[model samples]
Target: MTVSKEQIAAFYSTDTLAGDRMAGIDGLRHTGIATFMRCPHRTALKDVDIGILGVPYDGGLTTRTGARHGPREVRNQSSLIRRINVATGARPFEAARIADLGDVAFTEVFSPATALPEIEAHVRAITQGGVLPLLVGGDHSISYPSLRAVTENGAKPCALIHVDSHTDTWPVFQGSKFHHGSPFRLAVEDGLIDPKRTVQIGIRGGQNITDGLDYSRDSGMRVMMIEEFDDVGWKQAAAVAREVVGNEPVYLSFDIDALDPVFAPGTGTPEPGGITMREAQRFLRELQGLEFVGGDIVEVSPPFDSAGVTALNAATLLFEMLCLMTD
Candidate 1:
């Protein structure tokens, strides 16, 4: 739908730094269609700089099965988000033209084979129109299709900065090579991301076998386990990530499972001893000036948490990632 100038004007805030944000002191956050932070929802990218799109498919899940509901809940919780960052004073709404681009409409949401390429096509349309796509995902597997779309099917490979509890580099699972656990592996093999420039942080989980961990290390990715992250702290970890992906076009994929279950217990696969909410916030905050092509926050399943803490955290982190995308 066309977002008219009048509609855009109606969403403007009195705060000069807030720009064209919809939800602010004057606007009611709880009312209106639950678009990301209640931004004007539009399918067209005519006047948009950043497009917030949702992929609501969890067919790739090997564990729990509720991430398909993630986008909707995230939309509801994101209304709580305001215009400017109180800590960093980064006014994202002012920095760029942003809009809710609606969700990826799926013809078949039951299989990754057909579904993933659909996602790629949708995101490719956004990127082809010169709009940076910030996706909220159904599962971590969604990142593969997004990466493929953002990099134009590996014709231009970009660096990957992944935050997750698992390495996600395993070859395949149960005869399916396209599950959530193997997106990075497929991305590397397909040349969607530069393995040498890839860095996976907050990796700490038990394994029946260590093939994923071994592949992550063998592929030359800088893997920072939770142990090392604790010792050096978020600043050092963020420094290493920035150094690893230095000045290259980068795609950031933040899995909600990277946080300890205490903070984010609504993921399909929860790992103990993960980063705290504060550390995750600070870590993302430190990645302010990177060349971010696109980014995603994945695997927030609301069925597990009646209190909606996971969705809230995802919305906050989504704001942080949006700030990183700004000039």
Candidate 2:
């Protein structure tokens, strides 16, 4: 095939209003400074130079190592999908003002004990301004604080839709009550989330033997195992989710380990039999019409990743969630 000059010119064009800024079909406008304030190292790596924010805090990891570096790795490989509005023909930024909002600020490095409160404060400021927060990395524990902030301003408890490989409802781990494995339990116990309106999808791992299953059931949370998911399919699952959540505000929390290790190996916890990338996409796309308050993509450990595949997948999933919210 021969290249055409006209096509080349269209692809290489710059924006006049943006003045020396790169232009794309999506017409995305970068605004706000919340992300840069979260983590300077990650902000510089992703948003400052590359026009993206990659957060890499993994202190909440319970099973594996190096999830703290997830943001950096995911951003490095996220360039694969540079073109915007490629899926739904709707520009996300145009629909609603969006920004990276960076990673949660950790008071003490690798100290889940101190990080939760800090994350709550950061997200509260973002939501207060009416800007939709798109958070990356750290771990599933990060969502607990984010949820607390979202509902802080007199908002009632919202439905929670968690896509993960583990239930993450353990009462406590070691001597710490704030581990990644126990965020949901803390949230529900604290009245930040409604367990009756909550659903945990794609849970299939050995941790079930260690009280994960028991805790989820006792807490009144709906658990949709991966084996059952294979039997019923995502469309039916989405219908069930809609039925449970109704018209209330909702939060979508995605842990990369919810996906099969082959699809997302660079996570704190890797399970063999998990949701495929396609199934995950189908599940997320089905939430198009729901009233989503906020969302997060967590647990991307860059050290274990080969060629940044896991981070790229995480970033793409974040983009898809954004599309669902804005579309």
Candidate 3:
């Protein structure tokens, strides 16, 4: 579908912070308030189909702490994004009523225990409004709460399409069960997702123990390590993901660490021998027709990023994900 002139005008004019500097598509990409591809910022979800939200809390980190800055850097890099997808000609802006809902407010940024509830509440509000949420996260830990919110307190379980280096199914770390490495496990325990219907891709790297790995296998999740991904190829992998999820309500969670450190070194836990950016794109594109209730791109640490490449890649992938929803 063509992006109407009215849509372009509304999008460019939506960010009032720029104050007349941006009036059309001719406006500078770098000069506006960075709101997820320069989309209009709206707190109220009236008539909104998709809400791009930022969860900027990283208190659940087990190691690196820089992912708290992920959302802002991603937004800045997302300014370079245009409205159309060159690969599939998907015009998300025209296909969906999308807006940048801005970042989730945290009253206790330093406490994951308290802050996580805030994440749940915020996302719950979005879903309750009948809007599909596309969240930009602070870390993988945010997924636990996000799943709870998206599934309506686990009353409705969804299939999962998880792309990450680690299974993130480990038990408590340092007496903390809410760390980034355990969100999926926590989600499963709470019945937020169907483990048999979940597909975890691009899992590689050695671990301190086999608990998370064993848990993922024992729980009946389709764990495709990087080796299997290499053997079966992305197309086949995409096929498995599609077959497993079927037509169920699905949530796609992409941890930047799923990409090789060379492609995404800005993550807190960078794993080598992961998938390439091209492979990631193709895999996501293959997931076009699935019913996605919500999705997130997490673990983008701008401080560790070299020349903002990671954030740029994340922004591009975010666009790809948005295209999937549009499809």
* Candidate 3 error regions (>4 Å): 1-26
For each candidate, how many residue pairs have backbone atoms clashing (under 3 Å)?
0, 8, 0
Question: What do the candidate models score in CA lDDT, each in turn?
Answer: 0.89, 0.71, 0.91
The predicted structure with the larger lDDT, 2 or 3, is: 3
Could you say which candidate leads in TM-score?
3
Give a tens-digit lDDT track for model 1, residues 1-327. 699888777656333222134544437777666788777787878889999999898888999889989999999999899888988998888888888888999998777889999999999999999999999988899999999999999999999999999999987789999988989999999999998899999998887759999998999999999999999999999999999998899999999999999989999999999999999989999988888889889999999865999999999999989888885
Sort all candidates by lDDT, best to worst.
Answer: 3, 1, 2
TM-score of each model, paired residue for residue: 0.93, 0.82, 0.93
Stretches of model 2 off by over 4 angstroms after superposition? 1-20, 23-55, 82-87, 153-155, 208-210
| Candidate 3 or 1, higher TM-score | 3
The residue-by-residue lDDT of candidate 3 on 43-150, one tens digit each, is 989988999999998887777779989999998998888877888999988898878888998887777889999999999999999999988979999999999999
Cα RMSDs of all predictions? 5.0, 6.3, 4.2
